[model samples]
Target: MQSSSKLFPVTLISAELRGDLSEDVYRLKPGNSPDASVELALTRLGRADRETTRGVPVVLIPGSFSNRRFWYSPKSIGLGPYLARAGYDVWIAEMRGHGLSPRNQRYKHNKVSDYVRYDLPAIADFIHEQNPQPVHWMGHSLGGIILAGALGGHYLQQTRVASVVLFGSQVSRIYWPLKVPPVEWGSRLLLKSFSVISGPRLKRGPEDEPIGLALESLRWHGLLGRFGDADKDWWAGLIDVQVPVMAVAAEGDHQDPAWACRKLMEQFGSPLREFLCLGKKQGFSSDFGHVEMLVSKQAQLEVWPLVEQWVRKSPEVAAQLAMQPDRDEASAVSADQA
Candidate 1:
């Protein structure tokens, strides 16, 4: 991947706290303040005069070992730009240690828990404060897991999230045992070790090779496997989550199989849930794997439409559709009786 010589401004704030994978830090000086408050920056990529039609504020959270740039990449396969074009106030977050949001001076390492406790909550609070409207949340891979964990708990409960969209994420490690590991042996040991050693080495930017290499490491460790029994049961409790959820998986993705993806939606037990599995013929490469589903070029044309439509539809509209009696049920009954 070619390096970008262009310099982008980034702010460094003081460390509020520290966690296993990252440190809780405020966005102080956006351009260069050692002691500023949370800062916001905007990048205009497309036609400026196109009347911006704002919909629900949408926050795009990237997967593990990645930064917000994954979503904003010029060649991103996901719906970041498409959603922006569709008129959603889209914001991409860089969890501590990634992208522009590195830890403050005192903090050294980044942690997965930091994402749940600090990164997401901060984003949710910021969006709510700025828009005063319900925000929509979308995450892929580890990002999805972090959001799910946060939503399941008390975090972000006060915020009015319109919906939650998880791509290739399950509630517990059980769904992806290889990714975590047995509790007896200390779950997340592999991940934690890797993060401690390699997390700081990762650089920010739109380079595909580095991103691919990072994902490859996770895949090899079985980080994408299905959750275990304990995790499955823990996730089952999250079925009571009131928010609408859309779970998507790729048919050819070894990281997240169709069954596991379906299981995630089923666990939600939300009548307002939807699941999709992208087929290889749908333009998804056979090796599309796990992370590529979000960054792959084909996702925009094939996978993004489902998400776009869901985001646009109102809760009332979705409820009405759900209330409609299943037409296929009658056909199934008739066939069974026959």
Candidate 2:
């Protein structure tokens, strides 16, 4: 078992300041089989104060091929800790076939349907069984696609979720074009070849890394940056979502264009919606890229405040937290009984 001290190094920028908050490993029951199981490696940082626990719990799902550890590093452009410091109870998740969770007989391969049918539902069930309160869901890139698909299906109705937030995610299967044609074709061929040769190579990390499966999920969406049929039906399913939602994009992310993010928001057609384009002019930047908003140094100053303010403003979430057992008080009660 990896201790929290070993899982997160102290030299990492955020850890240098905040230290290790709390960490735990969860064994998730398989939705499809009684004998099958999945593991979630989760870490929480920030206050254990009553006010912090009272705030809405934000479940952070990483993009495809990415793992929970991506958010832990000081150099991460991911958003796990920023939200934690800003007072949200942050939970970073690792999809099967990535990081600590590897494939088993039950989870044989990485498939889009597997994510929709098993991964999302499993996380929702785990959250409800343990916390028993509505949680706010946030996903990035392919993670966003999975969440969108799950919400459109029966999963949303079955889960006790409060709201949804998507960052740099798209509903359409077709992706925006790049400049060079050969570059585009070459990139596609490389990803396809990698997917075939790399069977479950996703377990490797930044130091001992393998080619990512994120491109596979994009391919599943038909967003390979080449011309293809638009996934309008899949896109249309998002219209069925009833909960409050906030869609965000980094101005610099070419992968998920600012225009596409705006278009997705327009599709929501709800009064309880907000969209933010971070950075100066909605274009690429040196510091902030597709994944930088969460882990970048700028996140503490620029992005977290907006998310913090928005979460605090939601009366439904605030009320939910107010009603839950206080973390410290609950701990004390348990201690006294012991």
Report lDDT (Cα) of residue 294, candidate 2. Answer: 60
Q: Model 1, residue 163: displacement in angstroms?
A: 1.2
Cα deviation at 35, candidate 1, in Å, is 15
Clashing pairs in 2: 76-295, 77-295, 78-294, 78-295, 79-294
- Whole-model lDDT values for every prediction: 0.54, 0.56
C-alpha positional error of residue 153 in candidate 2 after TM-score superposition, expressed in Å: 2.0
Clashes in candidate 2: how many? 5
Candidate with the greatest TM-score versus the true structure: 2
Q: Which stretches of candidate 1 lie over 4 Å from their true place?
A: 1-47, 50-53, 74-78, 105-109, 171-237, 280-288, 318-338
Task: For model 1, state the Cα shift of residue 206 in Å.
Answer: 8.1
User: Each candidate's root-mean-square deviation in Å?
Assistant: 10.5, 11.6
Top-lDDT structure, candidate number: 2
lDDT of 1 by residue, 1-338 (tens): 22111222233343321111111223422322232332332222222333343456788787765666667653433467677666677667765545665444423333344445555665665556556678778888767876776765546673387778888875432434544545323533433444243444444223112222232334334544322221232254465676777777766666567667666666654456666666665444453457666666666565677688878874665466457666343221111000
